[model samples]
Structures are given as structure tokens and as C-alpha cells.
Target chain A: MLKLRWIALFLSLLLGACSQHVVLSDDFPEPIISQLPQPVVVYISPELRRYVHRHEPEQGADWTIVFGSSQEKLFKSVFAGMFEEVSLVFEEKAIPDDALVLTPVMRDFQFSTPGMSKSDYYEVWIKYSLKLARGGGEPMLNWAFTAYGREEKSGRSAAGAMREASRRAMRDAAAAIVLNFMKQPAAKKLFSVAPAAKAERT
Target chain B: MRCWPAAFALLLTAILGGCVSSSVEQLRQAPVGVLKEGETIVVLGRRQNFRHQTEADFTRCVQNTLTRKKLPVKAEQDFMDEMFPWFQPRMAPTTAEALAKRLQEPAIADRLKQTGTRYIVWLDGITRRGEDGGSLSCSVGAGGGACLGLLWWEDDAEYEAVIWDMQTLKSMGKIAVEASGTSYVPAVIIPIPLVAPTQSAACRGVANQIGEFLTKAIQ
Candidate 1:
């Protein structure tokens, strides 16, 4: 009887062990790490706000801005200096109407540029989308520019220089837009736009 | 004689249990092909209409998060021939063999070499379905008592997936995720049960959830 009881206990323990999920905590496969350092959060500048306000006011103030497409980082850096108080918001409705509605058109603009390829332009678009989506509640701005150049020695068309120039121009344009918006009373008015009763009281 | 029978039954259960346990272990131990540092990971997005946008957005969102986490990733346009091969019934067997070889070929191998990538991740599917409580029940019998239990009792949007690795040409993992979001109108209205305020907002919620999952796995 003693021997039988011991056997039953062992069997029960074995069954219990088998029934429970065997999670291997330590033997996990090592994760693959990339060589490039993770990409930085390139800030958008106040200039983009100014440019958008100037170029497209209806969509500028209420718009959620997306940064990057080469020009994205530069725009962020420039705009960081401009906004007196800038807070990143992840609100979905905060996204700009243009980004949601005009993505394809923007992609076309990027592709049509002389030196920039479809893929390169697509990267910019994607990066812009990411910045916008991840912006939390912060405003978004989109800008992309590319140039064309000819090889000096071979007299062949060289796109590298042109692409860089375009990227720079887009960055500058984004910065300019933000700056312009900062200088505009329209921006202040939009923020200060009050209910009719509140306006009357003020 | 009764003892002998009981012993035989116990032995049989042990054998069956061991087999099932080993299979799960094998799945966990399955080798994943290596993707080295600086290697570009190309992800392709496919779906219909607004659904396509959602999937693309999610894919890009994952890619960006991964990149930010320091994974060298590239979103590519051209689909590789080896990755997807065309073969008719008659040529299926031979073509399948050839395709497998092609996947292991030097061209793809060389590109992988360029950045020392040893792993490739492929996202195959995402689906959302309303849960049916009646269909989720299971029965179990113990001693003289039997009972039915319900599985997955929730009001939510769920995503399912099959992910594969390029190097080993094997599936790395499968995941199922569900989330609930509030639906609100312009005015502060009573919220809908589980639907998100907007589809894009739902997509963002899903992306963040997936990001958290990936972070847990990769980190």
C-alpha cells in the first residue's frame, strides 16, 4: 500500500508538470540588432507653421504636422526654437487634413522631382506619416523638395546634389512656414478664437 | 489485474503527454535565421481600400518604431521573384523545389550580405471579427461531473497574424491582439461599446499595441 501510494504521488506530479505550460524564460533567441543607431526624433520648426499659414491657412492652424522626408528633421529643429510653448499630442483628430487627404498628391510631387526616385520620395512620405501619427497632440507640417544636377566630369546627369538641394529647400520652406505663422496675428486669433458669449464678455 | 490495467493507462497517458509537450518545445526551439546589423528590412503592405490604408499605416508604424529602436529597416517597392514564385499544378513540385533553392540563392544572399542581415520578418495577415460567445464554449469531464467553459468573452476588435523569417524560411511566431476604443461624437456623447471614434484612431491604437508587443519580444 505504501509503495502504491508513492507511485500514485509520483504519477500525479508528473501529470501536473505535463499539464502546466513550460515557459522557457532563459533560452530565448537573441534579438537581431541593427548597425545604424535608432533614428532621432527630428523636431519641426515654427517656420513650417508660418509657411502653411501663409500658403494654406485653412489647413495650417488646425492641421496636424508630419515631420521628416529629409526636410522633416531640419523643420523640426527650426520650429523647436519658434513655438513659445510646444506640446506633442497624440490625438488622432489633431492630424492635419492635408496629410490625411493629400498623401497621394504629395507622393506624386516627390516622384515628379527630377532627381528623386519613387522609392526615395516614398520614404519621405512614410516618414512624414510616422511623425504625424506619433505626434500625439502636437501639430504637424509636411515639406519635401528635390533638385537636379549634371555630373561635372562625365557630363552625365547627377541627381545626388540635386536631391540634397531639394531636401534643404524643403527644410527651409518648412522653417519659413512656421516662422510666418508665428508672426501672423491669424495664428493668435485662431488660438484665441472664443465662443460668442465669451468674446462679448471680453 | 486491476492494478495492471491502471498502470497501462497511466503509461499511455505519459507517452501521449510527452509527445505533445515535445512538439511545443520543438516549436519554441525552432532556429530563426539571422539578420545582421545595418541590413535593410523591406516590408510590403497589401489590403483593400480603407483596410489597405490601415494595414499600410500599421506596417509603416511598426517599421518606424523598429527603426527608432535601432533596427535597420527599409520599405521596398519591388517584390522579389524568389519570395513569390509562380508555378502550375504540373510543375508545382519541381517549381517548389526550385523556388526554395532560389530563396537561398546568392543574389538575395548578397543583398543580405551588404548589411549583414540574417533575419527577415514578414507580416502576412490582420483580421478583425466580432466575437460570438455561444461558439466559444468547451466541455470537460472530471470524475462524475462535467462542465462547459466559455473562451474569449469580450467586446473588442482583434488582430491575428502569421509572421515568417526570411533566412531560415520558417515561421518565427504567431500573435493575436485585441483592443477596445471609445467612439465619441463632436459633442461629449455617450460612447459606443467597443468601436473607436474613427478608423484611423483605431489603427493608431492597434499600432501602439503591436509596438509594445514587439518591444517585449525584441528587447
Candidate 2:
């Protein structure tokens, strides 16, 4: 009976060692960009703020990754720094008149492990879709971008590596937003070109 | 008992008997100048290349080595955060000229001044495994276990440091280090691996030269 108990304990320990859980709640630094000379409304949806990912490896136990409030913090820091005046809104109707409304949706999240990829790296990729409109009207510009991050398996735990890779992926997404926002022609039309239309909206 | 102690010492020496060789070269474009008070240097790893990216640990290792050698270096992450999207992988300047032109922006220029950044060292390159040969095998029985074989491999590490004077908006010079070595593992009932410190030797070589280059006041 004691031998059987020892075997069971060893099996359970082996199973426990294969499971991993990661929670990301860290804050993103405020981006440094020339503030848009217009008022902006950032809408953070519940789906984006509280995202969770779960996956099971080939021979290991389940892996759960909880995004927590990182998405909310990222959008907050990004839009607040990009616009002169900023307001956080949950609903579309609460947007102010003549202000630009930016809404982001978490489209897809994927990750690959070293064992899976036959590489010595843990990688994370995040896809985001952004909707841009004026005063909660029809969407003037719709765009989707993917961001990626990778970390080498340099003696870090599975969960620790995944967490760092996820944060880098989020930061990469934020960079995509700040660096590519002004490059869109439709976006440029709304943010820069239409003085008369902007005056009316104001 | 004395023989046992001598055998243990021999084993210890064998475990640390890794062989490594290194070379360092530098090219200075302008006269070496002295650092001003309240000035800080930033050692940043360049990641624009898709084929090879400078290892983050190596970058930090250089930073730590420089610190131990008494050179002031700002934390790369903090410096990148303060610069924000400007220094992100997608937006960061690839060339010294591009960096100088980007510094012309008032906001970026002011941030550089506010952060008291005088020099920016960009680390680029990767440590990769070279040709390797040999293998080992092990076998076990109910009463005993024993293995006998030999394994060996080679490692190559090459890195370059491009120094840019942020204050003058000029390329100060470049420093390159190359290091290579072979590792061995011989098994006689037990495997005694002799690992090479090729990457570490390259890191130290670059860091020590950087220390000498920055500290000297030839201007």
C-alpha cells in the first residue's frame, strides 16, 4: 500500500509540473507622440479588457493565460498621450460631439512554444482591429494590424517566458497604433485635411 | 584519502578546461571627447534584422560588465520607455544618419536633452553555433549503469558596437569583437563536459574596449 501511494504521489507531481498559468496586469508606459490637436474619445470594450486564453500542449497539462486589465491600460496610455483632450467612454452614445472615437477589438491571440516550434523561443502574436469615426457616426476608417513578440528559452520557466512575450506583443501593438495611425489616408483626411468639416463638427 | 583528493582536483580542472580565442578591433571617426557632468550613456540592442537579433541577455551582460568596470549606463528598457514609440522596433532609426535626422524634431530633441543622453551605443550581432561533430551514448542495467563516448562542438560569437554621439548628432566610431572556441564532453562511466565561454569572451572583449574608448579624453 505504501509503494502504491508513493507511485501516485510521483505521478501527481509530474502532472503538476506540466501545468502553467500566466496573468498579465502590468501597465504600459505613456507613448511620446505629438498630440492630435483634436478631442478624442477612447472606448474600451469588456471583451478587450478581460481577455483569457487557454490551450493544452501535446503532452503537458492545460495552460491558461489571463490578460486581466492590460488591454485597458494600453489603450488608455496610448490615446491619452496621442490626443490633446481625452475622455474614456464605455458606450458609443456617450461620445462627445465633433470628437473622434477610437474603438479597438481583440481579434485573435496565438502563441507557440519551443517544443511546438522546434525552436528555442517562446512567441506570442496578437491581432487588433480598430474603428475610427467622428462623433459616433459611421466608421470612416477600419484597420487591422498584427503584433508579435518572441523570447529565447534561456532557462526561464514556461509561464514566465509566456508572460514576458505577451507583454512585448502588447507593447508592439501599441507601437503599431502610434506609428501607423497618421499613415492612413482616410485617417489623415479626418485628422488633418478637413478644416471646414472639422469646424462644423466642433 | 590523499589520492582521492588529487583525483577530485583533476576532475574539477577537467570540467573547467574550456578553450576560447577572441579578437577586438575599433575604428574611430572623430577625436575622443570627455563626458560632461549629468550625462548618461545608453547601450541599446538593435532588433531590426529578421534573420538575426542581438540577444537581450548579451546586451544586459555588456551593460552589467560596463557597470562593474565603473562606466555609467542608463537602463536600456527605461531609456526605451522614456523615448516610447520613437524607439520601438518598428519606428527606431536603423542608421546613425537617420537617427540624427530624427533628432531634429523638437519633441525628440527636448526629450534627449531632458534625459541627459550624451552617447548611444547600438549593439548588433548574434552568437551562433558553428560546425559540430561527435556524439555520446549511455546504457543502464538492473545492477549497474555505465556509458562511454566522446562529443564535441564549436561556438562562434561575433558582435559590433556602433557608437553615436547624440549631442553632436554624429557617428563617433565602431567597435567589433569576434570570438570562437570548441567544447568537449568525454564520457567514462560519467560525462565530464568541458563547455566553452565564447559568447562571454566576446562580450567582455567588447565591453572592456568600450570602457577604454569612452573614458579616454583625447579631445
Candidate 3:
């Protein structure tokens, strides 16, 4: 009996040593087109540019937490659903005469896991800051939003949970940005006014 | 003795998987100062593109906690409207530096000055349910019915408080609070579930920390 118990322990330990990979995918909620407003150009600052790359395995165990895809691309995908016309860029560009600009900053991202558990879980948190302005006007709005996600160790592979948490956190942040932007009077006023007639129309 | 191996695995898991885990860090400290009696402070949740109930709850929790500590703290009912009347559904300065500059603009500065708000506390964070799985099936025969299955999942909560001194137009400090735990629902013949106190734990922990931090700052 003692020998069998020892063998089981050894096998569990060996299996635990193996590492797994997880990816952070985008999950933006469906949009309400009528509710969404004017087109805006999006710019990402260099500071918020890193893809989620973190590995905090349980003590003496092997597992990795990796976020797949350029975080810049993932961010662009998020805002695409919120605006009628949208453009994303990493490098700074001069604002077009008739365009509104949005600058997003990835303030912080954190991930942590327990050293050991019957079920292994992962936690994620992200902080975001946004600046909005017209082509020539001083920035009218500046704000920050924070979102968090967790993968509870469960039936699916632990990797699935990790991925789910990352996606959810991103979605939460995106949702906050869209909702708050719509609430702003400036946003409302801008969108509320119908666009000018095309030059050719006359 | 024959089941010793299985029991060992269970024991190891329990020992390693601790209960509700949490921590708080002070990113920046409030400058040297003291709030005189009758001075006012306002707690608010940053309005985001979408509504975040946790922000409101956290704002209330912090305000109530601070008030209990003898600090005159309250939440502005129409903070967004009052502070940025011309621009609702608008943007706000994200960094302390940007905010300091924005507040310097005469319109915003005058409005805030009239309110006499000494400190502005912004509460932000998230709490969510993790993945869940399990299946159940039941059949009713001529005589009786039978069922079987199990379901389980985990939950987590994290929050941070950013404090700003209106007069100085600089960040007083920031405190981040976090908590997470697992829960289970099992069924051999019946289902049983263990609930996790993720958000409440974070709330309580953060509230206590803010209280303590303010008390110390006053002394």
C-alpha cells in the first residue's frame, strides 16, 4: 500500500511539472449601431504596447501565461465596434482638420496565481487611460478605467480559464470606454448634430 | 490503507490552496497635510463607457467607512453633471498631471472651488465569475425519478482607490485591493455548493485600509 501511494505521488508530481500555454483573445460585445456615435481616430501610446507575456507557475511546477496577438491589434478590434468610422495607429500623427482623436494608454496589467491548489486559478487586472479631442480644440475629456478577469480552475483545461479571464477583462474595459464616452455631453452634442452636406451636393 | 494514495493527493491540494487571498499597495502617499474639522471630501466612481456597479458600491463603501472614522466624507449625487456640466458623456484627464492642468482652466476651477471639496476619491475595479461546467440529466420511470451530476467554478475581485487633493491638484495616493477564491457544486445523488466571498472580501479589506490610511495621515 505504501509503495502504491508513493507511486501515485510521483506520477502527480511529474504531471504537474508540465507547462501549458494560454492566449488572450478579444471579446467585444455586440454593438447598438444607433447608439454609437461619430467616427474617431484611435492612437495607442508606446507604454501600453506590450502583449500580455507573463509566467507565474505554481512553486516547483511548470505553466506559462501568454497573451497571443499584438495588444495594439486587440485594442483596435475593441473600439471598432463602438464607432461608425474608426482608425487605429501606434505612432503619433497630425489630427485631420475634421477628425476627432482618441489616445489610449495601457497604464498597468497584473497577473497572479497561487503557488499550489487542488484547482489552479489565475487573476488579471488592467488599467486604461483615454484622451479625447477635436482636430484643433484642446482635449475636452481625459479619463481612466480599470478592468479585471479571473480563470477559475475547473473541468476545461486550466489554459481555457486563463484565456477566458483575459478576454473578459478586455471586454470589460472596452465596455466602460464605450458607455462613458456616450454619456459625455460633448460626445452627445457631436453625434447629435447631422454631418454637413457634401460639397458636390450643391 | 488502500486509499492512502488518493487521500494524499486531496491533502496536498487542500494545504496548497489557501482561502480568500488579498493584498493592498500604496502607490503614492498623500502629501503632508491635515483636514480641519468640517472640511469636506467626496468619493466617486469614474464614469466609464459602460456602467460598473462595483465602482458605485466601492464609492459608497469608502465614503461610509471614512465617515465612520470621523471624517466628513460624502458622495456627489451628480458629480459628472456638476463638475463637467458642458460636457456630459465626456472625457476626463486620465493622469494626475493632465487633471492638474485641466482643473487650472477657469471654468472647471471655479466650479470646484465653489463646492469646497478638499479631496476627490475615485474608486475603480472589477469582480467577475469565472468559467463553470457540469451537466445533469434526469429520467422519470413508472415508479420514480433519478438524477446525477456536479458543477464547480472560481471567482475573483480586484479594486483600487485613487485619492487626489483638489487644492494641490496632485494625487494624494492610491490603494489597490484584491481577493479571489474557489467554489464548488457537487452531486453524487444531490448537489452541494461552496460560495466564495470574493468582492465582499475586497470591499471590506479596502474599506479598512482606507480608514486606517486616513486615520494615520490625520495624526
Candidate 4:
């Protein structure tokens, strides 16, 4: 009876292992090693907000596994590294009188299956349109960034591969935003320029 | 065994009876309000590649069905021509949000308002053939002709109709339609192909739902 019980337990464990859903980790590195002088507010575009929350996969693709936080939260974490203060907002709200706003639009996020051989890598790609707005002035900076991630392990199932690939792509995208937006001349101007000083209390 | 002919007839009827099936789901509900007299709702395909006849046929079917239900819908071609003249071919917004924002712009907003467009129906989706498998073999021998094998394939399509409320410049709601079926062909000596009206069937299903949704006739 004990041997039979042990066999049953082993079988259960094997089935459990086989049926486990892929879990990805959010290990996106901050783009900027150091913080900026002031905080930058981040707004996710309405479409992007809905899309991330919807989490609908394209046909023929397996379910996507997001690591720890939702896409919005993950984005907040990445942007938090860009400045001393980072605020993530969903709806269009009154921005701090002096705050610069960064709106990120997810134009496309795609996951592709592996090649004929299951060992082949799966591809994950993300496209972002980052719009920098200051005090309702014409968007000061409009940049589009595309990043790709590949899963090379043969053993990882398609969903697992997608998770890894998507995680890496997000990280790569964050890195690009940090470097491109922070280091650019316009971004410097944005950081240094004081929000139109409130009519000097005259 | 003499009843085999009757059995085959019954079998064929059964197989053909379930050839096409589609369902509509309201992912978002339409806002409560009556459209003003003479006000129009516009139907448009959301992709450039949709200029093909198949897409046009789908769009027209939806418009006609809605019109039949007493909803005032604008001609897709007219809407496209007036709004997106620069593109030569018709153009559609990249995203629903973008279109919403565009509709709020004075230039575009003024034009759309002038046309009395209260709701914009975005028809986006594609009908496609899906997985297929089977084989057919045929040959004429000295004794007679003999053929044996099976040929089959899948036909599937998905469509989403996202309704935008021009008044609020927001998405009122959306409806998604999914249809899929398998087509079979049998061969005794020569391959006989059975083509399914997959795309046409999907078109009708989506159009029927749009009609029902707009008319608020859905139960």
C-alpha cells in the first residue's frame, strides 16, 4: 500500500509539473543609473491602458505570461528610474503645474511561435511611441522605439519562451527610453527648464 | 445494405447542415440615447488592405443590414472618400483611441459633425481559411475507375466591430464575432471538393449582429 501511495504521489507530481503555467520574472534594469533633478509624470495612452489590461493575444499564439506586476506597473517601475519623482496616471488629469509629462503608447506587442523544431527560439517584439508633453506645448519630443527578445532554450515551451522573450523586450525598451530621453538635448532642456514659473506672485 | 444510399443522403445533409456557425458577443454595451432624426452612423473598414472586394462586400453587407433595421448608416465609400482623400486609397485610424482623438480635432470634428455622424462603426477583422488535411487518389484501370481518400480543410474568421460615440468621443462598446468550420471533400475516383461559404457566412453573421445591436433588438 505504501509503495502504491508513493507511485501515486509521483504521478501527481509529474502531472503537476507538466501542467504548470509559465512564470516570467520582471528584472528590467533601470535605464538611468542615477536619478534626475526632478520627477517626470508618466501617462499611459488610453488605448495602451486598455490593451495591457485586456491582455488579448493574437490568434495562433499561446497565452502570454507577464512576470510580477501588470504592464502598467512594470512601466511605472521602469520610468521611476528616469527621474527623482515618477507618477503613473491612467486618465488625463491635471498635471502638476510644473511637471513634465511622458505619455507612452504601446503601438505593437507581438509574440511569435518557435520554428518547426520546438528547440528553436521564440520571438517577442515591442513597439513604443513615447510622447513628451510640457505645459500643453506641442509635444516637445516624439520618439518611437522597437525592441526584440529571443528565447534560445530548447526545453522551454512556447508560452515559457514567450514569457522570457517579452520580459527581455520590455527591459530593452526601457533601457532605450532611459538613454534616449534622458540623454537627449531636448530632455536636458525639459529637466532644467522650470515649469513656466507661476506669474511670479506679482 | 440496400439502405446505404438513403444513409449517405442523411449523412450528407447532416454534414452540410452544420457547415457554418457564428456567434456575436457584446464586449461593450451601447450608450443609452436615441439618435437624432437624420443622424447617421458610419461604417468603415479599419485597414488599408481591406480595399479588396471581400472587405467591401463585408462592409456593404453590414451597412445594408443595418439600414434594413431602420438605422441611418452612411455609405462606407462616401465616408472614406470625404475624410481621407489624401491617401488616394481609403485610410483608417491606426487605433480606436487615435480615431477618437482625431474626431475631437476641430477640422475633422467639424466635418464629421456637418455630416451628422453620431456614431462611427469601425469594422476590423479578416476571414481566412484555417487548418486543412486529407488526401485523394484517383486512377482509371482496365477494369474500371477507382478512387479513394478524404480531403478536408478548415475555414475560420474573426471580426470586431468597435462602436465609437461621436458625442463623447469615447468607445461606447464593441462586438466581436468568431466563425469557423470544416469543409470536406470525398473522392471515389475523381476528387470532389466541397467549398464552404466561410467568409460569406461570417459576413452575414457579423452584419446581423450589428443590425441587432444598433436597433437595440438584442435580447
Q: Top DockQ: which candidate number?
A: 2
lDDT of 2 at A96: 77
Could you say which candidate leads in lDDT? Answer: 2
Q: Kindly provide the TM-score of model 1 when superposed on the true structure, using C-alpha atoms.
A: 0.28
* TM-score, every prediction: 0.28, 0.88, 0.44, 0.45
CAPRI tier of model 1: incorrect
Interface RMSD of each: 27.0, 7.5, 13.3, 18.2
Tens-place lDDT digits, model 3, residues B1-219: 535544544454455342577887767665635766544677765543334434445566667778888776755554443552221212444444555665666556565666666677767777778777767666778866645554556778888877777677777788888788776544333334456667667877877776766665457
- Per-candidate interface DockQ score: 0.01, 0.38, 0.02, 0.01
**Per-residue lDDT over B143-198 for candidate 2, one digit per residue giving the tens place of the 0 to 100 score:** 67756677888999999998878777777888999999888876666677788999
The digit string of per-residue lDDT tens for model 4 on B1-219 reads 535644564466456543777787876555535688767888876644213213555777778878887788888756653453211122235566766765665646665777678788888787776888878787887977756677788888788888887767778778888888778776544445667777677777777766666675222
Q: Relative to the true structure, how large is the alpha-carbon lDDT of every model?
A: 0.33, 0.81, 0.61, 0.63
> After TM-score superposition, what is the CA distance of residue A72 in candidate 1 from its true location, in Å?
31
Clashing pairs for predicted structure model 2, backbone only? none
Where does model 1 exceed 4 Å of error?
A1-202, B1-35, B47-54, B76-117, B125-157, B186-219
Error of 4 at A32 (Å): 44
1 against 3, candidate with superior lDDT: 3
Q: Please give the lDDT score for candidate 1.
A: 0.33
Give the i-RMS of model 3 in Å.
13.3
